[model samples]
Target: MGSRITSPEDAAARTAPPMRSQITAPVAKMALSSRIVGRGDASFDGAVNIRVETSGLTTPPIVTGKVPAVGSMITEGKALLEITGRPVIGLAGVLPMYRTLTPGSKGPDVLQLEQTLDRLGLDPGTVDDEYDTDTSRAVERLYEKAGYDAPEPDGRLTQAVDAAKAQVDTARNRLRQARAQLDAAKDANVRDTSVQQGAVDDAEENLVDAQEADGEAKFKASTPLPVSEIAYVKTLPRRVDEVKVERGGTVDGVVMSASGASLVVTLKVDAQTAQRLKAGMAATLDLGEGTPIAAKVRRITKNGNQYDVVVAPNRLTPSQLALLRDANVRVTIPVRSTSGKVLAVPVAALSSGSDGGSRVEVLRNGEADLVPVIVGLSADGFAQVAPKGNAELSEGEQVVVGR
Candidate 1:
């Protein structure tokens, strides 16, 4: 039978422990003795208690083979408590495990492997960073090159799984060699002096030329051709001639605004080339004829090729306009013309020397004497040389490019 509560206090007493319940306690003292050893400095500590608890009620002592000698009583006590509650107990030494896998001993990275395979002339097809059939084929070829008994480059790699280990060593060596070359090129001071010097000079010259030509070409290409107003006149005797412009009548599109009938030759030249050319510059116009017509450049347009320049006849008259119309002409644009005595060499006979200078392998005393010459302006495949005392070099002298 359950007891019924008459008051709230009675209900609380029934729900919890009864307040009237009391007991007498024992007064005997017990001491605990503990020693922390097996470390650098041995230590001891004792604690006393006045409880009448049973001997079996004490917590089990923690035993350890080695304890690091650190902080005094505070740290030692905390470490002891933690070590007892640990789920695992073992020695302080590391476990013996073979370090077979290193920083790079895993399977090859697909991207780099694909690049290397391509470099070795083995097409891995796609560089998608996947170890697909193509990658396996490339690996097999690599193994074969490494002197391993691997299967063909068809992705059948099961039989040579162990032998394929050799491929890693071979590929690593190749990677080292490539890295060495890159390092050497990067460190200018350590690079081959002759090669670096020549490469730097040539690169600088090429870059300057490319930039100049690019800017000139863009500026010239964008400028519109010049338009001019013309007054057309019918031909008559000079004293009785009259010039007139009709309201709608047009002469067959006079290409040139200059007087008289002559052809206009529009030539495109870079700023550098234009510096050498000017109005009244004599040029030979070859209108696909075996013989060329001698013409004087009568006008120089502000924009070369983007605008046309009228070339007047130094000889012919209006009779030549029929010959000039619709005629495709190739003008002989001369860079330079030299006739006076100058130390000259045939262009074909010139070759770059090992010491980074231009040379002409001239036949001297029946033996090839490679003469390093500083060449000047070249015209028609003949370059003028300076320090001119090479009287031995003549117009028809044979020079060699190589022995």
Candidate 2:
């Protein structure tokens, strides 16, 4: 700012205005304070919709039994519905049944089915890859008990079983030949024993492979879940949310809706607000004008300008679970904030000093002095600030909010 001074006395008098009386105004002060002022909808917690698809041999079969009611809780090994007049029981596994499991089946799908069968009280051989005689027998028993015809071993499956068995035999023979040769070499004045040793080493590897192949064969005589008894689900003991199939209805696609034991509430917010929410952050769940319960942010998935937030309750009783299932609820996730009381001032009190730094004018003894301060987290109407260096500032002291 350019100023013209007619004389030294005039310059001094004009540049420095007379000090005014102390401006007693509202103080930017604080007391033990905490604020959870964020607003979000409060509804009952919702459930996760798990698609219930059949896994038995038939692509689409008629539902022969009564479908589980919408509110029924189906535990592990419990039947969801009858398909093809055979009950497809729920089993806990990550892999869904993809193909028919007959004799000679060899894959993780088969392995999982085998394990499930064993767990279900139906012995599927050694519970390995091979659907051996034991696995075939188990499948037959399961179907027989269910009053349905068991799965029969197809020609191709039988051939596969035979081939695997033959390989094992071949491996065993080769090992025997190598061992005999090694013995002969040992008894004789064998030069270049390395060849004998190498043969023995090769035989050992062959025998191991043979043993694995031999165990992998699903035999016609084994009792396995004839591709009709197994049902794959992400988790066990899921509650049935809806039943799309009934007696005589097509059980081809998702015949029911289910979910895990826990229920959660999902909400979306703009990215800016999403930034304030974090996974595992504590939250307050409001169920209408009802009592509030504690919750935690279960997950936060970001998508462009939007964010999906999932919150799970800390605990829920059986009654609460039934009440809140699929119920819309408001979840309040407190933004990351300054936890406790701190020296603070009204943001309006802060002014840019001549040095371009933050400072507040302190009004005391009918005079004002600039006190430099470092600003911190702001919440509600207070901005956390600390006096910098020797700049005198005290807790509960009045600071000039404005002129």
Candidate 3:
């Protein structure tokens, strides 16, 4: 059976309208999409930008060796490039290498170097500011792992050490001769014995001076680290973004640029929206691949009237990462949600009553009856509805949308 309806104008005019129609639809039982009021959609305009600057220094400053490939991940204690036929290694440290480090050198830079070496299992002894013999040996190991030879001390220093050793040997020989002479003079005369004893004492003192000189010379002859041979990076395992120097080109200014290995998505929002967001909040990333990826909020910063939000995606497979390396994507964060399923109806089915309360028309036994309802949430052209007072409403029920 079909439903019937009468218009107020037709009844008041004492005339029947030529045509009247009615339509019907069923109520929907589903979840309603809701979001925080005053919030807008967030999207990434482009890929993450890399801006970290790095450079190398050498005597010739010429790139005569292998360079890291662009987009490669560089780890700690790995060689970044080759300069002047020597490998320039990258180590983890906040302080930059400003001066050449050598034996007997002591400072905060040396301490940082020692810490880095120990982290790499190079065994820099004592991990102190003073670079001693153990530190020199550990540096040698560092160079060995990089497939290069450690720089040697100056030739003049090695020659001085040799000369000092020779002087000590001569003094020892003289002391032995004086002792023999004293032994012979002891049987001859007391005055002769005293003179020989004085000669022996003088020879012993000369030997002591020569030995001290030799010790100083040896200290100066330990291994040395040139400023150009090492580069200290604040973080390890960064991705190579740009390589400015080629194999035959000369190094000038910034030689390379790198940043964090993992990619991040950035977007701008209003201050109110930013306040609702915090670090580690879950989000969905849409790369336009027909599937959404999981992501989280990394940080939020203010810029002028707006705020910038950085989102980090979960660990992506190599293929997925490569596919979306430099592409734009959309992100969606849910700020509010319904607790469970509820009866919902199209917004058109809802109407305001004389009491200013919401109500819906339900079709029952070919009769239209008004059911007073309370609207919980309205979104996406749908409104969540619950029966008010004694009125009854359930899922899969037919409702009159028009008459």
> Tens digits of per-residue lDDT for model 3 on 364-386?
88788899999988877789999
What's the distance in Å from true for residue 357, model 1? 5.1
Model 1 / residue 349 / CA error / Å: 2.4
Error of 1 at 280 (Å): 1.6
Candidate 2 has its poorest 10 consecutive residues by lDDT at 32-41
Model 2, clash count? 33
Please estimate how well model 2 matches the true structure, expressed as its whole-model Cα lDDT. Answer: 0.70
Lowest summed lDDT across 10 adjacent residues in model 3 is found at 45-54
Global lDDT of model 3: 0.79
- Once fitted onto the true fold, the runs of candidate 1 whose alpha carbons sit more than 4 angstroms away are 1-263, 304-310, 317-319, 340-343, 352-357, 386-392
lDDT of model 2, residue 99: 67
lDDT of every predicted structure (CA atoms): 0.40, 0.70, 0.79
Candidate 3 wrong stretches, greater than 4 Å: 1-58, 187-195, 303-305, 339-403
Using all chains and alpha carbons, the TM-scores for the candidates as numbered come to 0.32, 0.66, 0.75
Candidate 1 versus truth, CA RMSD in Å, comes to 59.6
Higher-scoring candidate on TM-score, 1 or 2? 2
